[model samples]
Target: MLKNLGTARSIFLVAGFALVMGLLGPMPAGADENCREVSLPDGSVKIICQDDGGDEGSGGPGGGGSGGGERTCEFNESEIACSSEFGVWDGRCYARVASPQPPKSTPVWEGNDDGVILECNPPGCVGGPAPCPDRSFYWSPTAPAAPGPSAEELAQRAVAAMNLTMGEIGSTPPASTSDPNAVGTIGLPIWLWIADRAENTVGPITREESDGGLTVAATGTLERTEWTLTSASGATVGAITCDGPNAAGTPYDGRNSAEPSPTCGFGADLNSSPGSLTLTGTAHWVVEWQGGGQSGQITVPPQSNSTQVRIGELQALLRN
Candidate 1:
């Protein structure tokens, strides 16, 4: 019968059919009796291992056999367990762990050919030591709020400084003739008042801006005039009255026609001592006129001709 059974099993295996073993006899004691059947949709058959009577098969303690075992094992998508040796170091059990590297060192400064040692502390450092201090040291402290000068104070200081630099009391350059038909040159003298030696004499004068910043009015008496002409032969001629306030009609006005009639005031001596004249002071002038039956004031801007005079030069002039 065993020979016939072996032959029959061979035929079924070759025919790709399922075969059962020991179907008519009892299995031996201590032998696994549990059987597992696996069937493919294509009619293929599989024989799985099993456990019997507390016998532990290749499956682990729960009898859900591990590796090649007879038990059906269910795996959860959310729960995971690592198996390979490499997976342990890769943080498969938890989140990945990172290893840290060392920090970089600070750079040092070198001078010329020699290398100097420098010390550093939190915030900043104090170069060298007390006795032999470093060539250079710097401290960066919070700055204090700055104070500002008042407008009047600033203006006063500027005016005083200017006076000290320019000369006190000078005359402006003579103006050229106005009429082409005029025979002789027509000119006017400008007298400057300087209070101190430290003051600057005049500001800049420019015609390009307006009338070349020129003042044509003479402050002294044009009438009752006196002239002592000396000839080339060294002969003194009698004083003659070439022209006066009576001669020239009211001192020909050179002011702009659009402007009001400008008047020239009497020349008055400025009371200044040797010391007072040397001190700095501001120079100012005003123009007043009556025109169109209306009287008003016009302030002339300080020109280059207006300046601060220095005290030292005035003192020297007094000595001369």
Candidate 2:
């Protein structure tokens, strides 16, 4: 016997398993006999409730049809009734789908979040002397149908879930290189890059989502980063698109500080703007996905990260 848990519920019976979706609500009288409880493969109990004939004539794609004419159809004709709103009448049994859908919280589709209906054969037939067979359902052919998102769309959603980002700008001179003064010489090469080349920032990051019996997964990688260096006055000074194997840019060690960055670098003008220089790095990402027996690549918006550094001129060089 299952206690009252939710007003409405959808049962997802699949691959040797079952999932029930519902919220807290009151159960009607006689609901005990109308519902059957089964133990899930995971040792959890799910209450499969029989659809009341109330939704009859609700009219829509998933709506319960006219009340009088076809309502006489029953699963076994003796113990179970076929007047449920979860399936259609197709002579032998209801042609249904055993597809997985994205949760409401992360909807792959635009604006529907009530939940999904677990379509079943024989309409109202859930549990009785003879129950629905396991995995005997067809794929969701028209449920999430046209106007619904495709595998590629789900892949895009998977990529979005990764929350990709660009890292703060890093420079060879190290913004704090001179403590209380200038950190770069007006004419010296200042190494530039997107700091912290990690999975989240410069990926090879992966994520996935399952729907309509297929699971779509996407992997994203940092393809390149475009860097723009501007003077304090907002005038462009230099630009470089880092597309090398190490596109994140190499950090500067003291040994190579004097030399221009072998990967990405720029020299300030002798008459550069009076104060700081703005360095901005925009990251480009390539996301590829495989699912639904197919695969493809996606283009996402670029992410930009920036930082400022103080550059000064050498008044009078005094060397021995």
Best model per TM-score: 2
Candidate 1 stretches greater than 4 Å from native: 1-142, 151-153, 156-180, 183-320
Enumerate clash totals for all models, in the order shown: 44, 0
Candidate 2 lDDT by residue in tens digits, 91-137: 33343333554343432322444434333454435454334543133
| Backbone clashes in model 2, listed as residue pairs | none
User: Which ten-residue region of model 2 has the weakest summed lDDT?
Assistant: 55-64
Candidate 2: deviation at residue 149, Å?
Answer: 4.7
lDDT of 2 at 89: 40
- Residue 199 C-alpha lDDT in model 2: 80
lDDT (Cα atoms) of all candidates against the true structure: 0.24, 0.58
TM-score of each: 0.15, 0.51
RMSD of each: 39.4, 20.1
Q: Residue 187 of candidate 1: its Cα lDDT?
A: 22
Could you tell me how far off, in angstroms, the CA of residue 237 lies in candidate 1 after the best superposition? 15
